[model samples]
Target: MAAENKKKEKTATCYQDCCAEVFNFYLGHSGEHEAILQCVHSVLPEEFKRIGAGKSSLDVLGVGSGGGQVDVQMLTLFQSTFPGVQITSDVVEGSIKLSNNFKALVGKTANLKNVPFQWHIMPSEDYVKQVKATEHVKKFDFIHMIQMIYYVDDLASTIEFYHGLLKENGRLMIIVETANGGWDTLWKTHSKDLCTHTITEYRSSAEIKACLDKMGLKYDEHPVPNTFDITNCFNPKDKFGCDLIDYLTAKEDFYASVTSEVKEAILDLLKNKCSSQKDGKIMFDSTLSCILVHA
Candidate 1:
């Protein structure tokens, strides 16, 4: 990003502007969602083995469940693990468009027809505030914060608050890019210009491990391997290419705003080191890690 723009207050990354583009990128680039699902599935079976031992229904909370794609996958996993058990899912998302899209998806999916879903169109902070003010004691069997904790102000406090909401043996799951991933590398390199409070700044599995350790919390971590094809990004002038770059960097059209030197430097790293050519395809590592903490 440009130095002048960086000097000014950074704007919040708006999902409404680029949600479709992001989903399309995910669909085209890599099997990130599936990889994440696999990692989560690997960890949950053991941690949640007691979920339906006697109970018939599960209470689930999905924080920042954009479009409900992953939320549906997790809920489906729960159902498959405990057959015939109903689930009441409370989806927390700030985007109206994405929430509506999720509802539409639920309406069309045959398996999800029986599941009851509640939509809370607000940020996690607001939801926490409301719960605290109302003295609501509703507890959940599972809570998933899928790549959403970066938007939170205080990670430790937020985890504590949600951790308290979990029933006995309940699991609080979190997913984030690994420290060695390109996303973390980009943030570590360009935090002064690109990083902001609204965007996820310090949210890698390694960092989260430190937080959990400091909080005296015990958890399990799983590493997921994934890759993204970014040959289109070799062209800096193309609008779609620039938009993809912005999406990857979590900035609004970052390539368009940066100087030629800055753009060239970033692109050079992406082409030369961050990504590798295989079968004439430039693939960038997009690995992620999932952590599960007990209540």
Candidate 2:
């Protein structure tokens, strides 16, 4: 957020210190809401007026609402398109700070006057407890998990659990980054074995489909046009050249894997790779896959 820190991170790697780094990027990153909203629109029903017609309010649930940027965008879009729609959203997330921030942002906006929000703060395990209980099942019309399901050890069960939370015709959305980004290259070149993504099982869409089939759920998949572009991720003035080195390199093997020279080269490559070619703007060639299914 500070200019010096920004430069240290360069235009590329601003999210250095925490687990929700990229998620937070959506909150503070300029122009990202537009792209995110685009994805949301494509995934949501075209005629949401009929979503929960005749109901006093639309009840929705979000898993890993994170910084709540996605919810804000949805609220903004709904207010513009369906001005009279009342929304009651229950967000099941654990971070108290992020929840408070989401509350603060939504509370200040007049457009959200018709939207009521409730936070169900708990770990996924506890959430599972309430969800698995028959008395509290099938309570929501919509449930969404974006880039959050990967954390679950038993992903198929997690998917099924969300399915149990849905009311009839209730839709569940899953948004995840496909490994098609220069991610493979980054993983091979700069990323040490310390924190690699799940490349073994359940790595791609094919695998996801298999899991869905095993669960007897039908889904519609869409490719989102957003990517993680870290091209401007550098500051030659600093010793490590970027702030990412702080969080990314914690072990000796990790540090040993990336020397100063390799780091600089990777940064340069990221900058150039992320730069605009066809449209005169940085491009997120990164792939995103979303699924809408019976919850």
Strongest candidate by lDDT: 1
Candidate 1's displacement at residue 261, Å, is 2.7
**Cα RMSD to the true fold for all candidates:** 3.9, 8.0
Q: Model 2: what TM-score?
A: 0.71
Model 1 misplacement above 4 A: 1-14, 17-20, 23-27
Clashing pairs in 2: 12-232, 12-233, 231-270, 231-271
TM-score of 1: 0.88
lDDT of 2 by residue, 9-110 (tens): 321111223544544544343344555568787657453544555555567888877768788776676556555667678887766767777788888877
TM-score of each: 0.88, 0.71
For all candidates in order, the CA lDDT equals: 0.77, 0.59
Cα RMSD of predicted structure 1? 3.9
